[model samples]
Target: MTSAHPAPSNTVNAPGTLAAANEEFWSNSAETIFNEPWVLDFQAKMRAFLEKNIDWLGIVNDRTSATEGAEKKMLDYACGDGFLTRVYHPFFTKCIGIDIAAGMVKKYNEAAIELGLASEKMYAVKGDFSASVLELPKAEDVASTDLSRDEFFNFDFVGVALALHHMEDPETAIVKMVERLKSGGVFLAIDLLNSEGVSESKDEEGNGGNHHHHHQGGHSHGHGHGHSHGTTATGRSGPAGHTISHDHPAFSIELVKDMFDRAGLTDVDIIYSDWKLELPFVTDPGAKLLVARGRKQ
Candidate 1:
């Protein structure tokens, strides 16, 4: 890992690609596109990425042993379908997930139960992670695990994936995620990089723009605001060969590194991974996703 701070010499304002309409669009899509076979395949790809890079067992065992078997906690900010939550459930003693979309939260809970995860192990709540603590849900009411909001902040690991671009203030979101981690805790984020500010949203067949489905599919360039069910593509194929499209805002590596530095994190590093999604008719060999990771001081 590199120890030096990133060169913030040529800072540029990240375009608010779908910041305004992302919430509404994603909320409507929660019920529709998230359940598509192709969308599910994309989510699997994301899970695979986490499984490859995240040492869940190592982190959990190390922390739990240090605390004399005290339960370790994990926070999934903007958790969406709780894809990462389910993966980390067995490793952490307590897992908490928060999302802006109620439908997505509902599905997260249902999926957790379907996976046979006990309620005490996983809890999904509908709320904006970017909101002030005063505006957050009652931590006690959010789950059976007895943890207060302040107590909830002391997490051993925090993961924010593919959801930062939709926020009105990505930097604030990063800062807040860092604030929630315990000392020496890890914070990891993976999302597209907007190096050239490319915001085009058209597939080969000229379907609707902004092809931002959850997990994996094709490259979408829009701010997804947590729309739930029905608005996303449901057909086998649209006017073209594939179905569904939504825009996703890409974050530049310089901007990502800057966010980590400002959040007071140490040992920050940027990694480029060959990320892609394979569907029945379409194989999206996606652009290099920027993974910004660090430890809280």
Candidate 2:
């Protein structure tokens, strides 16, 4: 039952280790970026959309909630500081949050424990999404790394929020993600849209690159151009000469649709487009937030 796609040949500029990037972002200005009241509100709305409309818990029951004794299992891929993880705990019977950053995972675990969600029913783990496969624990099994497609035929759902856009090869990432799902399982994704035709390019330092904005449609709606400056959640400048623009990777949207098709998923639905206003301090003006849902065939 395990399915894998050929490894992607395209090499996007490595953004360094995920942990380093997050640590830099957090230590330097993460509080300013993530602690804003408006940012919190936006996150709450997104979580609500996934929980209420997506029927996330019900989907975990193999998309057959009417069955009386179906056990539910779910994974929150690239789950940041477990912001969404906290919101999802009450809905699903068994939930696991995985993140690439060890620091992020540690913080999430602390939060979960504080919230009394560190019990056996719920947990968080440090995992790499770019890796080929994830070794997850089965419901009844104690501790085993012998996880294969044969042992667990399906996952009720897999969710990636704001995390996919960071990957260099999101298409390959999507293919691998879908292969982990069972028939009728759901994949929910929320990511930034590249409305401004921006591309990633490295500067002289060879540090992680930054996005340069290119005007596409007449959709300009945020701050003016040229080394855009804005306050962070903790009221700090993000990066030198970094503007808040909505320039996502070129293939972001198209790649999602193509992966859905290639994975043999159906009933592909755009649950929420333009869910909330993109943080003005992040990227280009009028940046869009897209939420899509697809069911594996």
Candidate 3:
């Protein structure tokens, strides 16, 4: 098992600081707050969506055959626990899973090894995704790295799954990811959508209210005071609060589309939309997961 302590190789100061301070929250609490059982179910749903919605295999085959005589590379940006990495391993000649959290990288590596994916063809690396500093030896150097002309530039596809929302500025992050792709490369983003806001109302007597109203016909449930709203133990807001050390932002469909468009991408397509059943304590049935794809111009 990997130690919970911060790795010496971590280099992104801000995110690394957040990760150091909140490591326990991310590694341990996530399994509880996010609810592993629910995550398994969501993974099943996502797998089904991939199989029925996108022609992933066909696309891979086409891309692979097209590049038969050359090297092909794909990246699973912010790959957590190697879930999607394992799923999409067959497509690319090389699949590199990069993440800032050492814990995630450790687990991803372990999973790859256990799953017999430890070959040079597929692997995970501990690095800062925002700054793209995989070789830096310390977390503080992430910002100083010059990403404007990095050497690992050639890639056929970059998959960002549930990662954009974790960044402070998703628009900028998406644009940077798009910039890293080769011309005509594919960029896929799979994320969650907040199903608007729904609040509970009290009765005239100030007692537990029974006035049932539906928002878009979705089921309604009573809200409890113990439900911590918009605040984590660290006093920060958003999903970061649930974790021990990092703050991850969430994104919506329109917001993502606008960002992609601004990045000069084309052939944008929303390939999947399915309810991401919330972990037992994090959210309700209102949150929906969305998968969007676009080609680099």
Error of 1 at 189 (Å): 0.9
- TM-scores of the candidates in the order shown: 0.66, 0.62, 0.66
Per-residue lDDT of 14-124 in model 3, one digit per residue for the tens? 644543434434454433432356566767767666656547323466346545766567777766676666666666667776666555656666767877864576766
After best superposition, candidate 2 residue 273: deviation in angstroms?
A: 3.8
Clash count list over all predictions: 32, 9, 9
Model 1, backbone clash pairs (residues 3+ apart or across chains), number: 32
Q: Give the alpha-carbon lDDT of every model.
A: 0.55, 0.48, 0.52
TM-score of 2: 0.62
Q: Write the per-residue lDDT of candidate 2 for residues 84-157, one digit (tens) a residue.
A: 55665554556666655554555656666777764565666654445344436455633222334342235667
Q: Candidate 3, 181: how far from true, in Å?
A: 1.3
If ranked by lDDT, best first, what sequence of candidates would result? Answer: 1, 3, 2
> What is the lDDT, from 0 to 100, of the residue 1 in candidate 1?
5
**222: Cα error in model 2, Å:** 33
Q: Can you write out model 1's per-residue Cα lDDT over 21-82, one digit (the tens) per residue?
A: 44454555667666677667667766676566555223645445534767678888767677
Question: 233, model 2: CA deviation in Å?
Answer: 19
Q: What alpha-carbon RMSD in Å does predicted model 1 have with respect to the real structure?
A: 12.0
Judged by whole-model lDDT over C-alpha atoms, candidate 1 comes out at 0.55
